[model samples]
Structures are given as C-alpha cells and as structure tokens.
Target: MRLTVRTNIAMRALMTCAVNPGKIVRKAEIAEATGASEAHLGVVINQLAQTGFIETIRGRNGGIRLRLPPEEISVGRVFRTFEANTPFAECFSARDNHCPIAPVCKLRNSLDTALEAFYASLDRVTLSDLTCNNAGLERLLSLEPVC
Candidate 1:
C-alpha cells in the first residue's frame, strides 16, 4: 500500500526527535534535514502533537519533542493515524465510490487483508528499531547538524 506525504513527514519528524532526545528540535531543523516542506511539516507536526505522538512548545525555546519514549512509539500506530482517514482506492471511499462492480468485487477484501498484513509487519517494529544504534540515521537527523 502506498503511504501519504503526511506519513513520510511524520516519520522523519519523529526520527529527528528520537535521535535528538532532550533537545527541542525545531521544525526548520527537521525540514532542512529531511527535505520536507515546512508548510506540510507544520500540518503533520500539529497532527502528531494532537495525537500524542509528539509535543510542541511555543516561544524561543519552543519546538518539538517526542512525548513518549521512542521504544514505546509504534510505527503502525502512526501510519494508521495518518492513513486511516484516506481511502485506499476509489472504491474504498463510501461517499466517492463509483465502481460499478462494488457488490460483486472480491478484490477489496483481498486488498484489505494485504493492507492489514503490511500494518501488522510494521507493528512489530518500534521507533527504536528504526533509530537506535543506527549511525547513519543519527548523522542525518542529529540536532547538531551534519557537516
């Protein structure tokens, strides 16, 4: 299943915060490092904060940080947060479905099963699995800024 730009931005922001533990990492910092648009990042950041994935602080020292430990954060949960509202296919949308075979299509069930399997696989992985001990991710996402 294809993921959305919002999910991508959310993961990058989460990893940046995970790698930078105690620091209040700025959105510009995340955007610069991840090459994500600040405007899009702002929307993702707000959603992440609202869903309790990350916390945002206002002011000079303000920025963002993970509200829970990285190890406790589930990638699947994050994916679901950003992906659930979006229909997987044109036929998947209740209001927008225009498929003539909706009553006879068995493919939707198969697609749903496959999607759930994908999420289940990701559910086994935590943020720590993505960030911990990974020198490459640290170098790129560190608050210290890569040279």
Candidate 2:
C-alpha cells in the first residue's frame, strides 16, 4: 500500500524533531531540511500537535518539540493517525465505496491483512529507532553541526 504525502511529511517533521532532541525546531528549519513546503509543514505540524506527538508554542521564541520521548512514539501510531479515514481502495471505504463486488471481495480482506502487517512491522520501529546512531539521518535532519 502506498503512503500518503501527508504521512511522508509528518515522518520528516518527526525525524527533524528527533534529531534536535531538546530544541524547539522551527517550521522553516524542518521545511528546509526536509525539502517540504512551509505551508504543508504548517498543516502537518498542527496535526502532529493536536495528536499529542509534538508540543507547540507561540510568539517569536516559539517553535515545536516532541511531547513524548522518541522511543515512545510509535511509527505505526503516527501512520494510523495520518492515514485515518483514508481508504486504501474503493472497497475499503464504507460510505464512499462504489465497488460492484463489495458484497464478496476476497481481495479486500487480503489487502486489509497486508496493510495491518505493514503497520505491525512499522510498530516495531520508533522515532529513536529511525534516528539513533544513524549518521545519515542526523546529517540530514540536524540543524546543528553534526560532528
């Protein structure tokens, strides 16, 4: 199953925060590092804050930081939050489904099972798992000098 652009942006934002640790990372910094637009990052940042993953502040000194520890933030949970209400296929949507074979589509179940398995694999991973001791990600995500 393909992941949404929003989810991709969200992960990039999370990784940006993870690499910085205690810093209140600016949206512009994240956008520059991840090559995502500030407009799109703004929307995703609000969603991440609302979902209790990151905490935000206002004013000139304001920015964002992870509310939970990096190890505690499950990638699966983040994917679910962003991907919620987004059906993988027509048969997956209850209200919007227009599939003619909706009554007995074996493929839908298979897809669902596969999707769950995908999430399960991601569940084993966390922000820390993605960032820790990873020279490449730290180099890319860190706004500070990575020695």
Candidate 3:
C-alpha cells in the first residue's frame, strides 16, 4: 500500500517532534530536515496540530512541539490519524460500492488482514523506536537551529 505525500510528511514531522519533545521546531527546519516541501508540510502540520499530535505557537519563538511524550506515541496511532479514510485500493474504500463481486470477494478480506497486520506491526513500535542516535539524523539537525 502506498501512502500519500501528506501521510509521509506528517509522519516525518511527527517523528521529528517526537525526537525533540517539548522543543519548538520551525516548519522550515522540519521541511529541510525531512526534504519535504515547506508548502506541503504547512498543511500537514496544521492537520497534526488539529489532531493533538503537536501544538503550534506564534511569534519569534513560535514553532511546533509534540503534545505527548514520544514513548506514549505509537506508530499505529500516527498512521491511524494521518492515514485514516485512505484505502489501498478502490475495493477497500467504503465509498466505492460499484463492484458487483463485492459480496463474494476474498481479496478484500485478505487485504483487510494484511492492512491490520501492518497496523499491528506499527503498534509494536513507538516514535522512540525511530529516533535513533545516529550520525545521519545528527547531521541533518546540525544544519539547522533547534527551536
């Protein structure tokens, strides 16, 4: 299943905030660090903020910060919030009811199981799991100022 760019950027922004919990991070800095478009990230950031993943502030010291602790934030929760209402295929969507074989289709069940498994795996991991003390992330953050 392919994730939308919004989902991708939202996840990155969330992870970045998770790694630096309670620390304000500029949108431009997150965009630069994640290589996501600033314009696109703005929308995702707004969505995340609305969903209580992060809070935004205004002014010079204004930026974004996680609303909760990284250990308490699960990957599954992120996906559910950012990726909700999205489906792997047309058959998977509730709006797409034109399929004549919908009642007898085994593929839908199989896909549902696969999707559940995917979420289950994500549930096993938290934002802390993705925040490694690796050189790459350090290098990325080093190029920008941490708010």
Candidate 4:
C-alpha cells in the first residue's frame, strides 16, 4: 500500500533521530538530508511530537530527538500513527458501506490477515534494527546528504 509523503518523511526523520540517539538533529538539517521540504516537515514534526514519537527543542543549538529509545519504538506503532486509514482494499474499510460484498467478502478477511502479518513483521523490528550500520549510514549520509 502507498503511504502518504508525510508518513514517509516522518518515518525517515524518526529513524534518523533513532540512529543519532541523544544527539539533537535540526529540522532544517533533516529536511535537507531527506530531500523533503522544511515547510512540510514542520507539520509532520508537529504530529510526531504530539504522538510522543519525538521531542522538540527551541532556540539556538536546539533541534529534535526521539522521546523513547529506538528499541522501544515499534515499527508497527510508527506505521499506525503516521499511516492512518491504510486499508488494503475498499472492502477492508469500516466506512465503506457502499461495497455490495461487504457482508460476505472473504477477500476482505484474507486481506486483513495479510495486513496483520505485514504489521506483525514490522512490529518485530525497531528503528535500531534499521540503523545497525552506523559507519555505513554516516558515510552514505555524508555522500548523499539526503538519506
């Protein structure tokens, strides 16, 4: 399923913060690094902060940092929070009352199972799992500047 740009960017920023841990990373730097617009990232950052994923600091030498440890931040939680309303099909939506097969659609049930499996797989991993290669990540970020 396709995720919104906001979700994608927010996940990246959160993972970046996870990689850096205690180090505060500026939003401008995040935007530049991720090739996302600072204006757009502001909104995502606000949402992430509200959802308790990250904390924001103001003034000079201020930036954002993950509120919880990377290992404690489940990928499933991130996906659910940022990628809301992610139904695999029309029949999977609770509000899709217009679907004629809604009452007896086995496909929807199967899809639900598949989606659950997908989420469960993600749940098994954490941001730290994604950032195991610190040196490689630093080199890549240095070269690309937009990881």
Say which candidate scores most in lDDT. 1
Question: What ordering of candidates by lDDT runs from best to worst?
Answer: 1, 2, 3, 4
Query: Which pairs clash in the backbone of model 2?
Result: none
Better of 3 and 4 by lDDT: 3
In candidate 1, stretches whose alpha carbon ends up further than 4 angstroms from where it belongs are 145-147
Collision pairs in model 4: 33-146
Q: What TM-score goes with each of the models?
A: 0.96, 0.95, 0.87, 0.84
Give all candidates' CA lDDT scores: 0.94, 0.93, 0.82, 0.80
Query: Candidate 4, which ten residues in sequence have the lowest lDDT sum?
Result: 138-147
Better of 1 and 3 by lDDT: 1
Superior candidate under TM-score, 1 versus 4: 1
- Give the winner by TM-score: 3 or 4: 3
lDDT digits (tens) for residues 1-147 of candidate 4: 777888789888886786666688999878877788999899999999999989999999899999988888888878878766665677756786579878887887787788888888989988778776777765443323354
In the range 1-147, model 2's lDDT, one tens digit per residue, is: 688989999999999999999999999999999999999899999999999999998899899999999999999999999998799998888899988888987998898999999999989999999999999998888899656
Check candidate 3 and list the clashing pairs: none
The residue-level lDDT of candidate 4 at 123 comes to 90
